[model samples]
Target: MAGEGFRSALEQADDRIVAGRAMDGDVAAFAVLVRRYTPMMRAYTQRMLNASADVDDIVQETFVTAWQRFSELDDPGKVKSWLMRIVSRKAVDRIRALRPVLDVDDIEQEAPAHSAPARVVEARAGIEALGAALQELPAAQRECWVLREMGGYSYEEIAEELEISVSTARGLLARARKFMIVRMEAWR
Candidate 1:
């Protein structure tokens, strides 16, 4: 009845309106956003993290962080990417804690369920090749690569996280991309 209408209204609102309501402490509006985004956020975290990482925990943390920082969202229209940035930062923190022992094998888990056996095998090979190429990169370059490519962070954000200048971040990412392009040519 009335609840259904309210729910529909929330669902119909654009991101700016929803985000503004959430920022103004509308729990129902925030809940609508959570419902809309949790699945995609979960999937993104799973891809960004290792199998051992508790993706549910990371996703939950993302929402909590988002709620706490809702007031800081300068562009409400970008809330989706903003949520993803939180997920990226949280997932990276988990990765650092689990690093030096990461299992790249979980990459195979992201493959399509209906893929042919040959596709699976090829995907496995590609993952190994990418992992090896990543290993060959300088540590700084690799960090920049993951933060930019996988985390979807801007150069400025990546630079701030790495405590480097924007120029350095751009250089590192550029070199990393160039190296990956060269090393991964076999797959293409």
Candidate 2:
């Protein structure tokens, strides 16, 4: 009974949003929308991004983009999902833009030395192997795995972010994990 009531309330709210009263010019309605979704966006962005400094910037961009495109939004009930997609794309773009340009000399200098302590060498090798394996993954698979495992997003949330179906997201994550586990075991 309680679940039915909650579902009815949600349906009514979504109806109001779809009717355009919320997007037409009601600041309070928009505020309610933002308040409902922004925390999830922030958490998703932070998980995908290595740098904390840029999380706020990416989140702000996501919300601003959503607000500007609100009228274009096809389904008001999917607002949370749409906002998550925006944040995911923005985070990936920021990461690509900030990818470091590595010098060949620096790379060569970091190569493991035979004389290094066994544990130290092993740890470095593990990190390097993991990095290589991650680089081998398709971008979409990698992002899904990282968001689901590292960011702790639900399958529904990941599907929304990647603009894929929940089943597809599940398949991608399962494949990604299987590959990583196999590669890590081989490394060991």
Candidate 3:
């Protein structure tokens, strides 16, 4: 327990120091950043993209870009958001590159679960329904929602990343929320 606590503390150390070391060519520091943010990046990219195969590639590319441009990071404290922005951009690029295809992976049959609680089953169903509803949103609105809600980016950041005005980002998010609410109502 003590060792786990120590490891957690190390991982939670100041991002600025770690990022500074990474900028100065410390491979281990960069590894720390990767370990800290990879899970969130993977999750964000997975949500942004419909296809599962390309999520890993997009996340890997995000880190690669961050590494190449380490010196350009103005604020190391914002590394988490910076990494998320990179993942968002990469996921968008991948989506644009691939012709839109209806992803049936989300609709595929799931393996049987033994002795799962009713709440767990219901929660899983809700999540699946939400994912299906997200898939139905327009690409622009979907990206806005993922960046704002899942990526935890602000409206200004979303606007800058998506190359639109702040009001547009707000509108997109609003529409997405409304659509999701309506779609999810059927699940209740």
Give each model's clash number: 0, 0, 0
lDDT of 2 by residue, 50-107 (tens): 6578999998888788778888878776777777888899999998888988887676
lDDT computed for candidate 2 = 0.80
- Indicate the worst ten consecutive residues by lDDT in candidate 1: 105-114
The runs of at least 3 residues in candidate 1 whose Cα sits more than 4 Å from the true structure, single-residue gaps closed, are 100-188
TM-score of each: 0.52, 0.45, 0.48
Q: For candidate 3, lDDT tens digit of each residue in 74-170? A: 9988888888888998898888888666778767865556435876788888889888999999999999989988999999999999999999999
TM-score of 3: 0.48
Could you tell me the TM-score of candidate 2?
Answer: 0.45
Candidate order by decreasing lDDT: 1, 3, 2
Error of 3 at 24 (Å): 1.1
Give the lDDT of residue 182 in candidate 3. 92
Give one digit per residue, the lDDT tens place, for model 1 in 11-33. 99999999988999999999989
Best by TM-score: 1
Show model 2 residue runs off by greater than 4 Å.
Answer: 1-20, 102-188
In candidate 3, list every pair of residues with a backbone clash: none
Model 1 has how many clashing residue pairs? 0
